[model samples]
Target: MKPSHAIQGKTSEIKLLIESYGFVSPAIFGSTASGTDLDGSDLDILAIIPAGMRGKISLFDIQHLEAELEALTGVVVDFNVENSMPDHLRPPIEREKVML
Candidate 1:
């Protein structure tokens, strides 16, 4: 399933999963957001950890959330931290992302 379509009707679940891991401003980008996803395409998701909570969240927590989201959406998930991403990649992704 397309990432957007796979997530349909699952907003509350997705939100809970995101919040449990201390992430906020969840959004979809790349092929999923651009409506260009093909079979086997991975879901590109951006989630932010608030400045105050940054160090409190662990790499394990992030991986756990990624696994959970992949299970929920039935797609490979490429989860990323918005703040930690390199500068050059931000513009196009920000322009295309669909906030959840």
Candidate 2:
């Protein structure tokens, strides 16, 4: 099923936020992918920011992101920030993500 308008709006906000941080990989995971469900679901965002931006993101920034997402999409949004991850861990997590 296609994602609801709320989910799509949140995704767009997240994209803009990621862009503001200079992330260009286009490898973002979660609801943007096919088969995602919108109702009663949260967003999962994973991106690799520049070295200088690492460890600089604070809890307040995350809270702000969440708030912005809620304001724009009217659904709860969650963010996970990481510098990198093991290759083997990516697929399983992405595959098992609960979008519905």
Candidate with maximal TM-score: 1
List model 1 lDDT by residue over 1-100, tens digit each.
7777888898678878897788899988999899999878899989899988979998998899899999999989999999899999999998999888
Off by over 4 Å in 2: 1-4, 9-13, 21-28, 31-34, 84-89, 94-100
- Tell me the alpha-carbon RMSD of every candidate: 1.1, 4.7
CA lDDT of each prediction against the hidden true structure? 0.88, 0.57
| Cα lDDT tens digits for candidate 2, 11-94 | 555567655655434233466454465567665555556777767766677677667756666666565554565677777666
- The most accurate candidate by lDDT is 1
Residue pairs with colliding backbones in model 2 are: none
